[model samples]
Target chain A: MSTVLTQRMIELQGLTKRYGDTLAVDDLTFDITPGCVTGFLGPNGAGKTTTMRMILGLDAPTRGTALVDGKSYRDHRFPLHEIGALLDAKALHGGRRAFDHLLCLAQSNGIGRRRVTTVLEQVGLADVARKRAGTFSLGMGQRLGIAGALLGDPAVLMFDEPVNGLDPEGIVWIRTLLRQLASEGRTVFVSSHLMTEMAMTADRLIVVGRGKLIADATVDEFTSQGEHWIAVQSSNPAALAAILTDAGATVQKVDDSQQVRGLKPIEIGDLALGAGIAIYGLTEQRATLEEVFFGLTGDSVEYHGMLGSQNGQAA
Target chain B: MSIADTAHTTPARTERLAVTNHAVPTQSALRAALVSEWTKLRSVRSTVWALILTSAFTIGLGTLFCWAYLNRRERRGDSIRSLLFDPTARSLNGVVLAQLAVGVLGVLVMSSEYTTGMIRTSLAAVPNRTVFLAAKTIVLGMVSLVVGMVSVFVAFFVGQAVLDRDGLGTSLSATGVLRAVLGAGLYLTLIALFGLALGTIVRRTPGAIAALFGIVLILPLIAQAFPEPWDVRIGRLAPFNAGQAMFSVRYDPDLLTPTQGIFVFLAWIVASYLVAMVMLSRRDA
Candidate 1:
């Protein structure tokens, strides 16, 4: 198990991809180790797909190298056994049957027909194996894509936006499958723009913005990094804000409520009592992962919708 | 069933683990790619339809042309025999239309991958571009060769049966008759490869098909607009005219000899294929 774990690591060293003047994937460096589902978190156009394509050798990086088990993906004679990737679920011939699609991929890697059948059954697509892939729903297409990935029983798996079109049930199925793959000491690297989804599935998070690595930490560490504050409402909000400020806690007034950071709920209550303020509400609010992601990537977002009118209303 | 149910109930996981423990036997990448390419070619409906059209047009049209020739000979008497009588070329005239069907099949072999976005999946599985393209070439070439041979031979035999009614049919033992029949199949196979090369270079169905038509059908007509000797010279060099020269036994001052025709036609295919190989390797999938 330990040997397999070590052999399944994916290493990207100063990997960069530039499309003419635009840098799609900057000089990002990271190692995805086995036994965990590492969520590649990035906003749209943040280069997550570009990075995955480079790792799979589907696209050449402008600089640096992406290695699977310390060798370039192209150098491996049978790369499917080393790593399986589902970069785009729809990147298949629609005219082909589901079974034939997987079979062709399997045969290319010297994988047997039996393994193709096994993966079809595993992905719950055995019933629709004979149907043309064009006839499948988006979720069924996702399943067929996954079955192609699992055809060789590879040690490392990479999925790009795997849950995009999945139903709730399909989403749960993939999350469990990713965890099971990792628990068996395999490397599982999945990309998503949704932080909440990552929070549920990923053990570690590799967050990127504008092709730059923002954070690489465990999920617990990342969540803990978000600001935790106590929301306080009082009759004398100004007095409560002044007292909280004096007590070394940063206080911001939002409407009639004072948001207090660097102080616990118990400490805020004591401060209010000492100040003789009538406290109406005191509730602790930890920033959700979604907010943290937005905060980290706000400046790096490529496109922003017009929200000037809504901003004045909030103010 | 839920993932958990499948995970625990099925022995797939344990079997996979055991399979991974054993060292996989090393197979040649080219061989694996060949098997994969064959599977891809056979699984698609277009391949079947194109081959059927190829055979149908070749045999059906060949018979129709032969019957028409016998009727014309009957009306004109033996006076037309004093001119240029190449019954073999007459019976195999269907290759003119059949080339388009086979060429389209060849174009789809390469261009459809790009149009369908299957190139990414295919390249991911077989990262070696040279091996992947080589395997495709071998499969397409072989399939086209076999289909071309079968179609042309059946067309020859069936058309001869129709032409025999007027005593105008040529036997295989006759001078240049067997070579003409066999050369027709080789000509179609080369055209298929030519279309594949064009498809790979263009990487689009409509663009590649248009380019193929420009070279095979329109080029000869365009050459005719040129003046005198140059017109005949350029016309002989056109891919379709050059291919026609291969199967035409009757000597004509305008058309190239069979040896010159094959060499010139092959040069076109080889040049296009080289450009395709360069683009395929340099460009990102």
Candidate 2:
């Protein structure tokens, strides 16, 4: 939507939540800025949803605060107008029609019925608006949830696992919707455990592991944090390995090829040329976002397979 | 349509919606909350079905009882009016069953959200727990009041019609008759409110229903097991027994006055509601 950008920023300051002895979120502090989609990334049980809940004031933090546009989310006079969140797609009265469900939330904020209809139409649920939410498939339910969040036309939107059960079309639809909302200059904060999902949809990402902030950077920067290595296939593997190691590069040798870190492909090519060894093939490999995610969150995973490596290696 | 087309059309639609700002008046939080809660209560099947059941039982059973009583008395060639036979109480006998339906409705009003995990959505909308709860109480209480009054009055009229066939019916102008009928309605509404409060405290449908039944039905039965003055004292103090005193046609020296009984029930409702609100604010959704 073409509109004036409302500068709303959500800031979490040392937010911590503990249930008895178990810490759900620990010392989380970050700012979600407007005009872009900021992905909240974490493995399951790493407190992404808990942090979102605290932001929406659904859960009280044990220590610290979640502020929206400088004040607590609950402190806003028109909270729905300031921030709209879909904490759970299925969190609705199943017996009520989808239209009535959004209407209920809309009326709470004194929003008009016309806005409800518009939102239902926007979510492509206008045809089945009268159907009970209980009968809706997961994708339809997710759309209904989005309809509720947009009921007030809030400047800030938060969605938790918006693509969880969506079909591919639904997934693409929400991705475009999130980007559209951000383009309208509204802050869009989406939470997901899938790194590739965030990589495709979010410009900036705030990643967490075991309730602690791991990285807060743009997608470009995040993916770049993954180890970049040059793979070299040489006529003389032994000479190339020595040359790379002597040049302060960590080298790992596999069959017929050497993985060299801390050296550019051009440097390796030059070193091979000086060593008088023919470079049969040379390639620079960058770690994928998925690999980066596994590397960052590997240690904090609540469950692990017996076959998985403990040193952050991809299984 | 292409993704580009969907994207192209969305902004125009958003702008159209954004143009008409409903201009919601800056009223008290409770006013907005009340509107929200009224929408929540009415848009569900449970409320409609429960009220229907309450009406059916209260009127149907009362009519049956009145007819049965008139038939039996006529066969014996005896007068229906007697010192021991409180016709008002007999005509309103259906309330004992009807109250359960009202109680279930009240409990479901709060507990259904818990079961469906909608409390998170609700609390996020209205973060002030006190205002949110007060609005719920007012909406449910108002609905229950209307339903209770309509159902009980219908039962009374139907029951009296049955008794009228035998020329032994009492009119609303008769001594204590109007009070008993109105009191029955008030009693039903109060009991439902009590259930709503218990539901909030328990946060589960079955648990709330069990606790409500314990207070409204089981406790009175347990009180009857005592002897002499203890039985009378405990029974008079129990929730259902004390509330029932409001609708009794005959005066009992052992029980509370109608006003006192209402106040006692009110105390129970207020206390439970406050505790529920306190616990609601204290706990995470």
The candidate maximizing lDDT is: 1
lDDT of each: 0.86, 0.84
Query: Native-vs-model 2 lDDT?
Result: 0.84
TM-score of chain B alone in model 2: 0.88
Q: TM-scores, in order shown?
A: 0.92, 0.92
Lowest lDDT 10-mer window, candidate 2 chain A?
Answer: A306-315
Clashes of each: 0, 0
Kindly report which residue stretches of model 1 are placed more than 4 angstroms away from their true locations once superposed: A1-4, A233-242, A255-257, A269-283, A305-315, B1-22, B73-82
Q: What C-alpha RMSD separates each model from the true structure?
A: 4.0, 4.0
On residues B169-193, what C-alpha lDDT tens digit does candidate 2 reach at each position? 7878888889988999998888888
TM-score of chain A of each: 0.90, 0.91
lDDT of 1 by residue, B1-285 (tens): 333333322223534332243355488999999999999999999999999998898889999999988767344645755358677888889999999999999899999999999999999999999998899989999998999989988998998889889677888888777888888999889888888888888999999999999989999999999999899999999988888888888886788888898888888888888998999888888
